[model samples]
Target: MSTETLIEPPLQDADALIADMGGRARAAAKIMATAPTAKKAEGLRAAAAQLRGQADAILDANARDMTAGEANGLTSAMLDRLRLDAGRLGGIADAVEAIAALPDPVGAEVDRAERPNGLVLRRVRVPLGVIGIIYESRPNVTADAAALGLMSGNAVILRGGSEAVRSNRAIHAALAAGLSEAGLPAEAVQLVPTQDRAAVGALLRAQGLVDIIIPRGGKGLVARVQDEARVPVLAHLDGICHTYIDAAADPDTAVALAVNAKMRRTGICGATETILIDRAYAAPRAIVDALVAAGCEVRGDTDIAALSPHVTPASATDWDCEYLDAIVSIAAVDGVAGALAHIDAHSSRHTDAIVTEDAAAADRFLAEVDSAIVMHNASTQFADGGEFGLGAEIGIATGRLHARGPVALEGLTTYKWLVHGTGQTRP
Candidate 1:
């Protein structure tokens, strides 16, 4: 092994790079602040076309990143996230094109009221200025985040993981070309140039430069960004999602939904991590068999493990885990109350759903559960922005105030009060 810094050509200085990005982004944010809807739409349309045109270049860059990732000992799941196929590339373009179709959120009226003093008050939506995104392995995020940020009239600076640096740079270049073609500010969507760790440090401390910092990845990376960043952060810590089968639930429906929830795209944040089964009506034998058939290893409580030799005995730790893989954690609860308590103790407050024919149970769970997205008789996978009809999303926000649930265009903007009076001053 060579005795050198892990990152090639170790970057000891971040001051110049940070300052350049900061000035450029701040200037871009100003232009976006007052950009007309037609202009922004044109930019998005141009970007989508350019992305499609540069498909071959993007693929080549992705191949290089994938090769390096394998040499660096990245896991299979990580590699899957890093790699992009033709369909995925098309989807990314489609998303940008779709964003062009959405209504311009900027300058929309939030609320209007008529006062007794003959004054009219209006609240209008406005962009949040510059956004800094720090993500891991997922190069698609470079396109997704940039599209969302630009559409909402905010400049963005993306910091992708080192493993996908080359791919991100190529994507960034294509986007920059689009902005230039449209006569828009090219720095509207900039990518951090180097893979040095100090760059992250500089980004975290750029309070004046960045309006918000969004972290998308595992819990550890998000936590670190949140802790270190001086700017405000929008983040999802962990998607410890869940699905509960109520006592009055249909066995067939439960078995099918549960199997699909855990097995379909298990690496996503929306996938079911823990399953709550109502002991009163669960067809434990048949359900366990279905899960096994779907290639999931079951870890359950003593009673559940005793029901079939297929299940392994689960410990207390199993109740509070988000296994983003084929492994599932199971528990048999007394009823809705017991299930809620279990979820409350372990959930990451991201997404949770219940499959039940009983209206009362469904209503109670929907009202009481504190997760961002609560579903009734639906798959937990629907917690995504695209599935929720947002067309695209930067990431789900687990934070409770101001913005919650699937973050979309409306969530990206803030409101300001506008008042007009016919020669009427403060009375």
Candidate 2:
């Protein structure tokens, strides 16, 4: 699809290829760690420019991926994630530029304190070195990962899904060109050239070479990386997100938000897969009808079935399913407590939202959801790094240790102690 001619070196061995890339990435990370903030920003901006300038070529490449996806029987949701047009391309470019505009997270002081003995210590942010990203289908991740990784002063090794290899290559080239324009090493943002699954194994086993691995695809992929990688991983397990319509929720707003959360780009990890309506809520039928009108199939309990024949009975598995499609499971809950309990049991701790005018209920739900992102009076789709103003995200980290929610520039970094002492050692 991309008409641009690319001459790739022959693949010798998966291990050898990974070793070479990992070594280069390690070296690149060292340089990126100390690179000036302005230079990093310049690289991001240049990549954004390249992305915008090469929109047509990128779209053509995406078309090829879409065709293949359909032939391979990819679901409509998966196909949507893989497909990209001029508008989405422009949005990706804009996200890169936004990353360029954000203040550099590196060197930011977390805290500083002076001891009585005159020893000054502070924790400061630093890049996490080389990041290995294994994602699926979405070609835009090539640009997003490069921009976020570079801005945070880290070199990245990207291994996108085989489904979008052609598109990823094209996008990677554009990003590489931008990095070169800014005098940054193109190797700083390397795309694994081959589609061999062995490469993933090699990368996962490359513990020292890669500082950390971030997986941005499905559960199977994440589970494989989590199970196999000796290196630390930042993973998003599932997006069994939910939207609860509280009794105090405005009927019109709840209906609109419910429809948007479930149907607006349903293929995304942020899309709400479940809707919980409070039993006291008077307009359950209206909310269900709205989602159905938006072409979403509603699988619900008997209460919802009583309102519309279009509603199907929800199975036990439906509660825990991340149906990244125009399908949602609805349940009627007794109150906020019931909604929270159901969410706690079924949610992947990714994101959940509650729509309510009652401040106490909203606050309680927010405090009790136990999710990476808990929103009040909003859609779960807001659970994105770009929307969180981190430019773009490497992934949505559901893990609680290093980072959680949207893993952006800040999340890409870890801090180290900077001690200023004049030979005041503890003797």
Candidate 3:
């Protein structure tokens, strides 16, 4: 569908291409690590200007992907993620500029101390050498990852889904032009120029060349990466996000949060998949009614099924489903304790929220839940990097070891101990 000839190579060539790219990325990472903040900001700002200035070309490329997706009977949600227009393009550019404007995290001193032996110790932030990003459907990620990687001083290799290859390439070209104009190494941000899936395997196994791998997509792709990757992976298993309506919750607030949290953007990972309502709430049915009116299909337990005829009886597996659609499962709980029990059993530990006026209940819920993101009296949809005051997200890490939720510029970096001392004799 692209106007230019797409050069898809053979499967055997994937290993060589990935290896070559990895070597270049490793080399670029060194240069990017020490690049001045002003230079990085200049390159990203130029890229933003280029993206907005060349909207027509980007939109045309997106049109090609949309047409092909429609012909292939792709679902509407899938098409929506792949399709882009002038507005979305402008938004992407704005995100890039926002990232540029944030304070640079590299070399910022986190802690300092003086030891008894006349030694000074300082811990300073440093870039994670090279990162590989594998994502699906969202062309915006190409720009987000590039901007964050450049600002955080890391070299990145991006591989978007096959469905959006044309759009991704077009976006990558604009970003590259800006980097070239600012004298930044274009290799600092590279897109896999092929559609062969074997390339993914090669990237996963690129152990020494890549420092880490972050996969953002459906469960199948993430599972494959976690299972096969030799490089350490930062990924989320599922966004089976939850919202609990406490017995002391204000009825109006509960209803509003539920509708917005689930139906605001049903296809996003932050969208709520299941809801738990306290049985003692005065108007339990009002929440269900509002959700159904907002075009969401409500599947509820027997207690909730009694609230409305429109409700469907939920089965056992609905407890752990990530619908990513207008479908939600609901259950009636005794109190905050019941809500926590339910969440503990079926949660993916990505995000959980509680809508309650009772401070004690909110505090308990917030402290006990072991999710990456926890909210009180707010929508689960706020689990995003930009909303958290970070410019843009590299990914939402549900893994515990390296980075946690809404990874941004700071999370893309590691730390090193800088030691300063006068000449001293060893004991």
Candidate 4:
């Protein structure tokens, strides 16, 4: 089939459409499982080339989505997430190429053991079969999902938000064309055609066909998928991430990191939604002042309110909210223990950071914080697969199971036990 025709067939019954896609994905996944790593790399590289070559066309489609988003009253942060310009497209293409350059995780032996019976057993990495990805507004997710899924030897069925349907279709077409050019089945990466909400329900119930479902969006969407999915789900509940300024923190460093953590692409899941300042810190006021100066709205407790006139008094709900915009909630804590307590009470456990010059304080915070990703003296914005050298991610898995942190190539794989024995029989 031609790439232009890869837009999925007309939507009929949602169940039947999902079933057909699931079956095709299952079949394509088998081919991908044993496909050579070099071929997979070639496919990803080709896709990157296609993205770069067709940047202008993709941007045009994205412009349509942007206009619609504006009409629909999407927040400035959301518009940023939905918007795609030439530079961002180039960055996306570069990320795909980086994925192609990474070492293949499949077939790598995770561990080996020899039993008393002289049986040599090995655990080897393998693909997770077909993955169903339901995400929102980010058109780049289409390419990221395709690249990560193909590189990890899995077929993907993407159900993106209606806001970016046109952009998703365009990006998916380029990806499918690249897969075909590399002799990989174009069916390896398929996007659900219709925006009907029923499509999500159908996909959730496709338990046997889809090995797992990964939902990447708001809390409501993730909760819905978790509640409705019959298949296993890899999800992040929320990004109510926090950054605590330790009592021993450097004033200059703390201010710089806090500003970047909250304002550098505020719409991303990694952006800091809350800032916890240690009461004993010499300059708690400085950190809050810096954030306000950087065009971030600070919603604060009494201490923070006292720091600046612009600081708005925070409500009870503000502490638990994930504001994916140019806003942050600030609170004062006693020390590391106080910060940890506050985080334990309200954090989504996605990502958290502490800025401190004290080695012991930093070590203690790192050891104590029960989050997927924790850092000392670094911006929470670093909680990303691309930043971690995994190219791109389906999502930051807040759940602890097969994966945690960035759901990259390694996280996408499962392992099987391979045993070698000489005519051994059970006693």
lDDT score of model 1?
Answer: 0.87
lDDT of 2 at 312: 97
Give candidate 3's error at residue 217 in angstroms. Answer: 0.5
Question: TM-score for model 1?
Answer: 0.95
Per-residue lDDT of candidate 3, residues 1-427 (tens digit): 5434446646667889999999999999999999999999999999999898778889888888887778778776688778798888989999999999999999999999999999999999999999999999989999999999999999999999987888999999999899989999999999998888889999999989999999999999999999999998989988999999999999999999999999998878899999999999899899999999999999999999999999999999999999888999999998999999999999999999999999999999999999999999999999999999998898788878879999999999999999999997779
Worst 10 residues of 2 by lDDT: 1-10
Which should have the higher TM-score, number 1 or number 3?
Answer: 3
Q: Write the per-residue lDDT of candidate 1 for residues 1-427, one digit (tens) a residue.
A: 2212235676767866877898899999899879888888898889988889999999888888888888888877688889988899889989988887888899999889999997899999998888999999988889888888888989999999988887898888888888889989989999998888789889988878888888999988998998899988888988898999898998899998898888887878888988888889758677788989898989988778987888999988877777777888888998899989998999999999999999999999999999899999988888888888787899999997657877778777888999998998653
What are the lDDT scores of the predictions, listed in order?
Answer: 0.87, 0.91, 0.93, 0.92
- Badly placed stretches (over 4 Å) of model 4 are 1-11
Question: How well does candidate 2 match the true structure in TM-score terms?
Answer: 0.96
Candidate 3 Cα misplacement greater than 4 A, ranges: 1-7
Q: TM-score of predicted model 3? A: 0.97
List, residue by residue over 195-312, the lDDT tens digit for candidate 2.
Answer: 7788899999997799999998998999999999999999999899999999999999999899989998899999999999999998999998888888999999888778799999
Q: Give the local distance difference test score of model 3.
A: 0.93
Query: lDDT-based ranking, best first?
Result: 3, 4, 2, 1
Task: Give the higher-TM-score candidate: 1 or 4.
Answer: 4
Q: Go through the candidates in order and give the clash count of each.
A: 0, 0, 0, 0
Give me the displacement of residue 291 in model 3, in angstroms.
1.0
